[model samples]
Target: MSKDFTYTINSIFFDENYRPSDGTRITTNFANLARGESRRENLRNALRMIDSRFNALANWDNIKRDRYSVELEIISVDIDIEGNGQHFPSIEMLKTNIIDHKAHKRIEGIVGNNFSSYVRDYDFSVLLLDHNKDLGAFSVPDGFGDLHGKLFKDFIASDSYQEKFNKSPVICLSVSDNKTYYRSENYHPVLGVEYLPNESSLTEQYFKKMGFEVRYFMPPNSVAPLAFYFFGDLLSDYTNIELIGTISTMETFQKIYRPEIYNANAVAGNHYRPDLKHPDYSLTQIVYDREERSQLAIKQGKFAEEYFIKPYRSVLEHWSENSAL
Candidate 1:
């Protein structure tokens, strides 16, 4: 895919009146900047944190504390799903373009995990929270995320995408604490042990339809494992700096979104497990209400169902029936 594959905000493509909920991906600091705040201090501070973190880790050359300069651009991408052969509104994305000093070029490109849906409110929150659902024997439909899967496939395969990006997009996700991932010998220098889950989760299955495979890697000196979705050799496809760019960015988000697990003040080790009820030490700089985030996801799912899903229920059902693999 040597074309300009620009990743548009698919979250808002399905709805015209869609507004980014307070709990969506992208830093809350950026959201404040979008709300007519003329001062750029907050945005500056957030960006500073990224650069600082990256500099502390980019110890390729000891003489230079900051070997690489990092900058983030919130690019707006408008991707059209050619499955419908039509146009939808452009989506807003807080895209992170990780640049390295040695390379002096863009190393890794990724969108933060929130505002995370190509279709306004995605199942990221609602369905994923099922990891905690105490309900016994509850079942999700086989076709549950087929629509998103199909739409995301077209989103990546679209002409606009091929023209805007040079490589397949990378998605960063978390390893569920409820599950245990056995460490494997296949490991890279930057990304530590490769952990394999007992089985694929529903989240992994649906993501596969969007042309992504899963990798469980906990970076060296990191506390826990993370679930990364992509289409190529995560270990060999990119340079160490490129991999670190993503690792640093995603870990920053996880530390903010899930401090209880990812952010503990202790010696980093692979066998570590977070005691959610009480961590040895977990501090949160930002206010991220997981409960509220999940609740809003339920609300958005209903909105999508009423506005987009039900109205085209028959068409969707037919698509699902014929497109099953």
Candidate 2:
């Protein structure tokens, strides 16, 4: 087996002129939003959702008035396989910078775990089903997310990422609804109530493939807890302000993605699940198009199958059989 892999990063190949050099179809929420006559309105509504969530999270210091806000920018990452020079959109994330109204200062920014790729399908759709299992532990065959994980690590380790951002990534995901949570004494002022899951879920195991361990922290003023995935000390890797940038930005996306939980109007609890059809369910700020999200995942999976999986199946098999993370 060939023990060599190479790629290049093209961070500037997105936005209005996002045509991939190799005819690679980029599937992202932003890409979908950019496609129609209502592109402006779509983006505008997204901004409002983020602003509203940031305000809610920063309400602690807003007793008198709004004391904080978040500024966000879309960052796109494209990769050219084997150094072929054909850029393919790989992932997209948000660079969130906090605005301290009281201090009138713009704090340093952080790369938040935002919507981007097909991996979301494995976590949200595939693993979510595992949550409903009445009698089984979460599991997947070894090397399940190995290729995806490696590709992700490569992007983060690339010069383009280090030179531009120079910061570790922080991924935030929704807690499994079917599992019970126990509040621990572990807590941070910026990262709110810490909850321990009863047991590991498939989602946790999946992220571990990409060098991200999970921490469940329900930030102040949040209705429920969130699972934060990171490579280093969740407490020490970044300052409180940077962590706030992550919490505020990702919490907004979570609320939009899984409002049945984030907007449930409740705190961390054991075995809590929201009834979407129930009258008590709160009306979400924006109606997320679940079909769009899921279909994009399908398209991305097909893309990977055609371009990477089939051609390199034997190579991937060799690597997986002999290597372990």
Candidate 3:
């Protein structure tokens, strides 16, 4: 571990086309910044949040001791489901790389991108056709209800997405269920570990058949449950090294800085949505009462010391030993 690793932050590697190499583990917060008031301001705030958090990581000591700086790049691609010449707005697809300045080695898996349930936001527009206007109040047609599902499936399986990463991507997403173990007193959420049983998640089953090894992880105090789709063995290398640290760090960062978005009851509204019945989407429970959901978040965060950090202690320790000079 004598060699130093250079970390680059917010650097973009893709061209105007937004296509990546094969097997690249693409990570994003799914237009988290792109959605709000000012795109520039949101991006600035997002980067600042990450920068401050990275500097706050316990492993590094000071500026002089800071061997791990990050390079981050934000990119997006447009998928035209319509054959018309009109193009949709650019989708945000970001890339991150951690470099070792001393050894000149580049680390790919340190930061995995995340996307929220926003697939419907962008792709849903494409599915809304003039012919299907009378389908329902949601404006989604009959057989086309799976339009979002099909688009998501095709995107991941598409050459554009596969080629973007040097390795298969680990797609992480959220799930909600009242009967799920996390809701039970006997069970609690843990980050970086699988949560859903194979039969429980439709999204998980879909990805698994597409050659992805699906594993789910939900952080303590997390508003929604998450599923991690490992395209190959990508999770193994990442978890053994930077993945744990990154997840924990982001957990703390979001709670402190983005409480409204990251809080435990944050996703309660999703349960009641009419779209939940769509086959293209995973099933979820609507928790209308704030009190119950808040209690769940509290309990979820309570066992952090016992369940998450402690269990992954060795992985964190191992990463610390090898990631530094």
- lDDT per residue for candidate 3 within 1-325, as digits (tens), equals 0121111112344222233322122223323223323545544544454444444442433455344444455544443322343323223433455544545786664334543223333223233434456655544345332433443444555566555555444444444332252322223223423444424544444444445575545444345444555655644445432443344334433443334434444342322221232333221121123344334333333333243334444743454444311
Worst 10 residues of 2 by lDDT: 12-21
lDDT of 1 at 316: 55
Question: Which residue runs does candidate 2 get wrong by more than 4 Å?
Answer: 1-39, 55-64, 100-105, 118-139, 270-279, 312-325
Residue range 1-325, candidate 2, lDDT tens digits: 1223443333332233333333333445445544456555555666666666666655666775367766766666665555556555566676777778888998866785664654444434443445446647754544566666766776667667777776788877788866777788887988988888888876687678777888888888887888889888989888876787777667766665666777666664544443443333365545456667667665666665566556666865665565443
Error of 1 at 296 (Å): 1.6
TM-scores for every predicted model: 0.75, 0.77, 0.46
Q: Any idea what lDDT model 3 has?
A: 0.40
Backbone clashes in model 3: 36
Location of the lowest summed lDDT over 10 successive residues in candidate 1: 10-19
lDDT of 1 by residue, 30-142 (tens): 34333223224433444555676667666767357666655454434543323443333333344455566665676545543322553435454454345348756656654
Clashes per candidate (backbone, < 3 Å): 14, 0, 36
